[model samples]
Target: MYELKTKENDSSVIEFIENVDSPKKREDAYKLLDIFTETTGCQAKMWGPSIIGFGSYHYKYESGHEGDAPLVGFSPRKAKISLYFATGDTKREELLKDFGKHTTGKACVYINKVADIDVDVLKALIHQSVAFLRETYPNQ
Candidate 1:
């Protein structure tokens, strides 16, 4: 069996943000916290040591692998901030077009700072991700 490393924990989201090495990143983390919470209507929770996640869902693939993951989250890393959203959501790509400057990986959207992106687009992404996950994994 494979273990999921980024399980949610009872860690302090505020403390984690406070410890960010860069003051600018720390401030942006706070800004993101507000945006995600308001957009998803879910309180922020710490996932693993670094991810500040809002809302959660349990998903199991056909291969029998199952785990709980946040509907949306972000981590303020040294190089760039990572935004975690639902994978396979087509609407995500559409919104990203107007999301200002950002880079995307398989399931993450990385940005340099909050000021570099449109806050409205960020909120839309969070909402769309949550909706997609709830629809995809209704059992959870």
Candidate 2:
């Protein structure tokens, strides 16, 4: 059986932020923490070693692979911050159009810092991502 490597753990989100090497990145991480927390109305949890996540849902694939993942999350990486959101969400694409300076991948929206993006748009992304996951998976 294949297991997900990035499962949630009991690590301290603040501790993780403190250990981040870059001072500016550390500050950005705290800001993201606050944004995600306030926007989602969910407390931040450490996902794997690096990703700070909020809320969660379980998903079972058609292939029978199943796992629990955060509704919305972000990582303060060395080069840039990586925001995690539901993949294949059309609304997400629409919001990204006004999300300010950012790059996209299948599941991650990369941003240099919080100031580089509009916080309101980011909140919309969080709300939409959480709503989409809940509607799609329907599993707590």
Candidate 3:
């Protein structure tokens, strides 16, 4: 099995975002990063090569696999921004209804542009996701 990397470096995260080719995309990345950090009250850092993740939660399943992951986070992908929020039992449509124009796949909420979505709605989703993760994975 492939193990998820747990270590994070904020400087590397910034450098990665800065290297993005589009100025608008770069700006949007930082905007999303700021919102996630502010709403979750958790520091943000890069996960792997692309994801800007927030906070950390450790979890172990019944099958005895255990690992740590970001409690809430998002990645600015080429086609759309992916917000990772599904800890299961998410009120996804309720959140997305307020999020303006966007799409979704599995647990990720995909946004084509930051301007396409209401910033306040995005912040609320981040907060809600973090709260859900905390509730679901508490002490686990």
TM-score of each: 0.98, 0.97, 0.88
lDDT of 3 by residue, 24-88 (tens): 88899999888888898887877777878888888788998888778778877787788888557
Candidate 3 global CA lDDT score: 0.80
lDDT of each: 0.93, 0.93, 0.80
Give the per-residue lDDT digits (tens) of candidate 1, residues 94-119. Answer: 99999999999987999999999999
Reference-based lDDT, residue 63, model 2 = 95
RMSD of each: 0.7, 0.7, 1.9
Clashes of each: 0, 0, 0
Between candidates 2 and 3, name the one with more favorable TM-score.
2
Tens-place lDDT per residue, model 2, 5-104, is 9999999999999999999999999999988999999999999999999999998889999999999999999989999999988999999999999998
TM-score of predicted structure 3: 0.88
Higher-lDDT candidate among 2 and 3?
2
Give the poorly placed runs of model 3, Cα more than 4 Å off: 5-11
Arrange candidates, best TM-score first: 1, 2, 3
